[model samples]
Target: MDKRLSDYIKKVVTEHGVTSTLKMKLLLEVFLRQSIFVNTSLPPKHNKRFWPSLKDIYNHVAAQFLKLRDSCVDQKLVVEMVEEQRSLHKGERFYIRIKKDQEPGKFTDENFGMTKTEQSMKLVNILWEWPRMDLPINKGTGNIQGYNIATLFAKDIKTKLKEILELEEGDKRCYEPHWRHLQWIDRNDLTDHNVMNNSVKGMEERNKLFHEERWAEMSALVLEEFGLFKPKTIIGLFSPPGYYLSLKNCNNGKLMATLEDETGQRLNEGVRYFKDVLLVEARIIIASVVKNITYREAEELLYPLK
Candidate 1:
């Protein structure tokens, strides 16, 4: 490995005591696994994983996924609307997330597209440092090309991870007790270069394509922030007034972050995630969110009504 890469791994894993961040997990998957697919394996430094009993599995599937199943419409229009929202926000400077069902009286258009809220900037600056930093992707190939990382794809990873960790059965989030171990990602996400549901691409690809210079500027911002500021805590990035939820894990500098306010609480202390664990989680998040289905309702999205 290049010395730079080696040093980064150590800095994140050993020096800082942060075993996993959004980008670090993706980087390991691309190289070690040679593919950006579903992953649930954790770093050896962490404790051994556990499995959910049959009841736990059933309950987990019901709590996290079944709700989406019951609510999901699984129509092409839903995907299109989501795509449109993503496209509209593709150019903003900071990360954004997609959310609905706003708490009554809490929703406001005033901050709908604001770029520099105090909480958002705090989270954004957190992202510019260690575990919370941007993804480790190669931008040489345009995002349209298959295999290159995408912004939405990375955001979905966090979405999936948050969902999986909330599961009653999942433990350390790796290896089989059974099919549940693969909960972070799924078979549907295996496609390459799928920027959207009907559009078709890999699990970690982004929908919003930015100009090269803008991409360069965002990527560079991380280094500049890191050189000057001290790293912040990597936990609990959600804010209550409603957020765009962009994780910014990839090189393109798009959305990447937690799904709900409680997601930050789910990060298991001492958990050290690597390539396989995070990739799988990414797949599941994409499937659940963009596909508009729970695990059971995935069939509806896969074969929607006419």
Candidate 2:
């Protein structure tokens, strides 16, 4: 990995903590490409339309990364790319406020005459500016492809998860929605329909592509952060009634987490070998009770140890 890339990873992790592979990959791709992909349903800034498919974007970035591996791409360009990607990946969730006279749907060269509904729709899209992860339509549940997105907010994953788990009693431990933002779209908007008609299929494919490409970047970031990084074990945490901590040894060359019970007893029930393969594939690791730490901490600790 490039030093600049490694530094950027550290900076993000420092700002956010343990980042998901998806987030990291998106960051790298953005930094390298200087282009950001956003759903037309949302608007933030002005950028030219680029990729037709998420796969196309990934392939282009991956190829670009490879080409620059030894050739030394411009660091300034890489930095700008990173900034642009960050903007897109974590763009603001504002909506456009359609004026009273403006239409509520998409205004075109033919129908630039906007209606109330069209104005409202455009305003909402303009405010939203980017595809939000909060909508049921954009969740990991209805994955048309065999791919899902995982995001980790550093402030939450490491510190808040345990706290949230502890705060809820029984299965009724209600928590706030963890996604970044909710995207609002007017079902009545013609622009939205046009966007969907033109981009939905490609959107799904691009989602998968972004998900995969981000993981690749994440894995590389992890290795750069902690070379030969591997989790010793992992433990699972469930609640009372049948709540128990399950621990499993992951010496089998896989990233695993150890869950500890309230009494600190390690069970053999959580993510075992080949179980948390996605974590390893994405170079994500969890902390264990024994170390009272996470894989991210271990990786960072190694930096000083060496």
Candidate 3:
């Protein structure tokens, strides 16, 4: 993350009275701007996005999901997406108030003549300006020579999910989803056809790409203040709810923290393993922006050492 952006976010979260949801959203905004793909071989922030390794990626994604799942969705962008979908479906025109002296009551080409997909994508970019997720859409027409899109929603695993994005069982190719905002899905927007279009499909593929991956028994505590260096351990706060970062990952000889109370420091239950896995993913949070307490100090405060 950029230093300027990092300092700005820290000030926003620590000083301003913003909700945790907004704080997480601000993180997401920066996360999207980075080169998050694992296939890239570029240096960590060679003037671009950077996460050390796969473990860091999974941990970051899990942390983000947990934050979003636990927060309220009263964002203005969400409302605008919903209303824009409704208006587009109803074949309505938009009216804008410009700062300059403009002809009143005259329909301009400002937001006119946009196709359904184009119009929807226009609003979609407000949340994320990245390329939309490409899914093999079964259009039931002439598909590419060799293309197949499987199913997880249907019991038979063969039936086309008509209710979700109108994917039929037939010819198809990789297609961009009409709605790319997955955030809209969990916000009780499933009833709204437009917002719920390809969010489900995107999530299904994302689950396969991320949520279904194997655990490495480790944790990554991401912080902008720490820069490119990934912090692996934290002063675990185990009190009833299990607020703690695995001590085993503190091989770097120090524990880092992002919060004073250790309230939002931990991994999502989806990636947490206990039986055989040596460690589970957790976030570093406690005592100021990031206080790297020595291993001795960390162990004294740590509980039931991992």
Candidate 4:
């Protein structure tokens, strides 16, 4: 991240009193203008348009940030917002205003005539911008969800993590949980439907890959943060059989594999040799399992996989 942009974001977030969406937009505009002349690496044009709009630039920046953040946590895993919620508890609930008359599927991409890749990138950006997490209460039903982290973790713990990472206050580091509400404004004036249908299809595919990648990424981060991979720590992985394959492939030999049944019974051998063991969650349905587990359960599951 650029130092000037970082400084500006802190200024707006702390003193501007403006909404996050507006602050991001303003910050992006300034960033692009400042970088356009100095940084010659940016493409001269995108989607047949010269000089990307503030929204386009912002989406690109957000996507890059997401990738960077994920890489810092775990290079092999690609964590998404939903998976992040599974590990981090939510702090507050709030509603963001949207255009009343906008259609169900319409979004900023529809208004900007962005490509499918661009739109999918934007959605990923939004997921990070407005992270949803589980509330500490309702650990069983999995119905509770919130938008921000309002002093959820102990201040000392947060401060220590920040110190370890060498991050100043208000930096958007992965360890520190915070709230960022983005106001969505409908753009009905621009009409470009020729590429809309294909773009929508692209988003569907992108979303599937995004979630899988995110799960792995968040899992790695949780393991490291909670010190679950320590020599004497007990770790459990409660995921479907399909997830096991990906975990094995990406874990880099850090996790030992063992088969287990739904009742938490070991299926492979009489002895559970490793600190980490794979167990099945009886309550999880293959189709809707992610939505079924609470954040606390998710933490319990991933914390030991370090």
Q: What TM-score would every model get versus the actual structure?
A: 0.20, 0.18, 0.19, 0.16
Task: State, as a TM-score between 0 and 1, how close model 2 is to the true structure.
Answer: 0.18
Question: Candidate 3: deviation at residue 283, Å?
Answer: 32
Cα lDDT of model 4 overall?
0.29
lDDT of 4 by residue, 199-283 (tens): 5553353244334333323222322233221111222221111111111112212122222232122111101211111111111
TM-score of predicted structure 3: 0.19
lDDT of 2 by residue, 65-170 (tens): 4443322123323444565677787865534333345354332222133454453333233222344323323322321123232333232232343232222112
- Report how far off residue 74 is in candidate 3 (Å): 29
lDDT of each: 0.33, 0.31, 0.27, 0.29
lDDT of 2: 0.31
Error of 1 at 20 (Å): 3.6
Error of 4 at 303 (Å): 55
Tell me the tens digit of each residue's lDDT in model 1 across 32-124: 333222375533423222222323323332333323432212222244456677788986544333245544223332332344454354444
| Sort by lDDT, top down from the best | 1, 2, 4, 3
Better of 1 and 2 by lDDT: 1
RMSD of each: 21.4, 24.6, 22.8, 23.7
Stretch of 10 with least lDDT, candidate 3: 280-289
Which has the greatest lDDT? 1
